[model samples]
Target: METKRFYQQRLDEWVEESRKQAYKGRVAEYIPGLAAAPQHALGIALWGTDGQFFQSGDTDLHFTMQSISKVFSLLLALMDSGEKSVFQKVGMEPTGDDFNSILKLELVDPGKPFNPFINAGAIVIASLIQGDGPDEKSERLLQFIRHLAHDNRLDYNEAVYESERETAHRNRSIAYYLKDNGVLEDDVEETLEVYFRQCSIVVNCKQLAHMALVLASDGVDPVTKQQVIPRRYVQIAKSFMVTCGMYNASGEFAIEVGLPAKSGVSGGILSVVPGKWGIGIIGPALNSKGNSVAGVQLLRHLSQDWDWSIF
Candidate 1:
């Protein structure tokens, strides 16, 4: 790995170059709160397992986790229900369709979700989380995230949560479909509440990087040297991050950046370079596939320049 000074200077220059990509995309507007984000803002934070940190551009800007939350929720579900049970409810394959598409749920027999990273699959994973009800489940998931980020202050953006709940008609339909297919064992509304709240958890780039660091270390907290999550579960989550985390663009990202990553509609991306660094990025402008345009470009630049790709 390069020195911190080297990364800092390159990141400073690269961020500005990447920010130019923002104009080619647009902020997500389906959720009213997300629509209010600054469209051109871009930021990145990288945390190394060796305790080096580098940040540049709009690193202080906060954003919700959105679909990135699905990665953790899937981990939690696996921890709660184990691999066999979780796989029974969701398949291991990625759907080439849009992240929220309901086409496969109807066309596929047995009706299990194609994978846990998509909205329908994540809703089913939310139901699998162990809790007394929606509130407990949401709280448990939140606490788990806080633990990963090592920031107990982490909490949901209530405005975003309410906005998502208000505008989640399609998600509701997906949940109902999953329930009808017997893939979801919990009440549809309650399960959705958990999913919505998880998606709304707010954090800046540095904090997001911290959370990614845990995953990069295979669920160990590098600072504390503690095994916070089981290694097997982390392996499973990272595999999904590779295969389905970028929605329909996973294969392109694999070839381009070659790191396991998860992207959110909020324009946040959590990515990990195995055994080295964990990265977090935020750029409000999104491509058609719902990934951060500037953020992806920035990662590609860094990966190519620094040879960070796992492949």
Candidate 2:
């Protein structure tokens, strides 16, 4: 068989294995909505410049963007405020705290939330979206993300939005603290609304993967041939991914996988291979860190098999 045939063959095999692996993990239980997801649900999808995608299992299930939205939220802030201006509000360091933890703001010197990937930092990023209110800001973010993914139909799932709103007391606390610290500009409730809305934007693996693919290709969808975001911005985002994408386990994952990736509580993992490929894996089962369990295994297997280690 030819090389292309062999790659296709392996891709099929991995999808099957991932489905079986999904059952071994447990659905994220801490979040009310997430805990209700089918524990056995599993999906893996891939999108590349070739304009072809291979997906398997329950690939159509809609899930919250959850933490994965932080990636674009950070980029939008950087794009609107410039990197230097954005960093003045949030630090690039990784903290080992739980994603929604506000303890670090007081524990650490300079008291900046650790990296844009964390909840506290992500809230600050939301305030920099350059709009008058939550609705305008969220629409701006939605438009940017839709363009990046080359999908105009993308929109928020109101159920997930309301679900998060009702359950986001912790996130609201973080947002208010950022405001108190002078890191957030928008009203606390309004900023939390935007943050919750961003997290509620639903996407499947194909949409999510293509979103990552745009970043992988330096903010250009090769198929669309449009430069959705500046190449330099993608570089910076990927840099942060390597340094801080995986929450508290970022260092461990970095040492093992060597790729800049982001994972969400919705069992979505957006893994990027800069200039080559972007992978999206969604399996609701989560570990202690709120990362998708089977999703991690799937990406780790793919990265190793494809030799996608970026380090």
Tell me, by TM-score, which candidate is best.
1
lDDT of each: 0.94, 0.81
Per-residue C-alpha lDDT of model 2 across residues 164-262, encoded as one tens digit per residue? 889788888777777777777678998888988998887888888888888888988687688878888888888888877888888889878889998
The local lDDT score (0 to 100) that residue 167 gets in candidate 2 is 79
Q: Please report, as a residue range, the 10-residue window in candidate 2 with the lowest summed lDDT.
A: 48-57
10 residues in a row with least lDDT, candidate 1: 1-10
Q: Once superposed on the true structure, which residue ranges of model 2 sit more than 4 Å away at CA? A: 50-52
